[model samples]
Target: MIHFTPKFYLIGRVTHTGTQRDGTPFSQVWKTIDSLGSGTYGDVVLQELQGSPGGGCLHAVKSITKKAHKNNKKILTNELKALIAVKKHPTKVVTFHGWYQDSQQTMFIAMEYVSGGSLERYMRKLKRVENILISSTSPLLVKICDFGIAKSADIDASGLKT
Candidate 1:
């Protein structure tokens, strides 16, 4: 396990810049201003990382507390594993930037910031505006996230169906 010592540059301002296990530069210059959503595991926040003409690059950061670590290690592991497994398919899934832990052992996952609201909310708005009901067959691009409950298939020694 990699442990990081928190660095506080200013009051209430914590910045972390270092290299990950894979030799990737992990930097957190953005501040999490508002929460996007929350679940049983943790809360997702909207972070402004890079500056651009159109409101810069926003990212969704998930904060997983240490308390959940003890009981949900497997779940956390599965989430990271699933993200890494599907990292190549950007169009089909959320882009997994990288994961890191703070000095307090709180894990954070940074991913591509999806501007549009969730599918459920989007459908609701569309129905209200267009006065048309949307069904599952409707052509819409959706990405499946929250891999904390994801499970990998088991394989036998023969490398065939068990």
Candidate 2:
């Protein structure tokens, strides 16, 4: 039987693009740069994707400690399903690379790291500017994402049910 894994994300992510000469997957090493935000459920961090500097790869890794809540796993599973549902529209939604569970059972969701600064920060800058407008050629679209209760019982790290 084929195995199906589940992926979870609330933003964009990076995936392994190639294998090594020995036919083994090249291991990825993620280094945390800073903390973006945190909440009752988990914390988001700015991570630098090492060994691929030229790719301009950076990811926001959201880590939810197993002790965060009693149903943390279930909530994350639902989030994963919602992420998968929007995978086709990556420009509007965050791309999900994948997730990992450490030995401590802390779930880490890998996503794209937006570097233009937070919306709030951008707004403040706009207020100070004499004239700020969206270019007709490139309109800015601010979206509020909402994913209702969703969960996938059969999902994991090895593979996801696309």
Q: Per-residue CA lDDT of candidate 2, range 1-162, in tens? A: 011122332233333333544655454555666887765567888877667544447776677776775655677777676666567675665566676665467777776665544455556644322112221224664431223223344445643343
Q: Which lDDT values do the candidates have, in the order given?
A: 0.61, 0.54
TM-score to true structure, per model: 0.67, 0.61
lDDT of 2: 0.54
lDDT of 2 at 48: 77
Off by over 4 Å in 2: 1-24, 53-56, 122-138, 143-162
Error of 2 at 53 (Å): 6.9
Residue-pair clashes per candidate? 0, 11
- Model 1 stretches with alpha carbons more than 4 Å out: 1-6, 9-13, 20-28, 50-55, 123-139, 151-162
Best by lDDT: 1
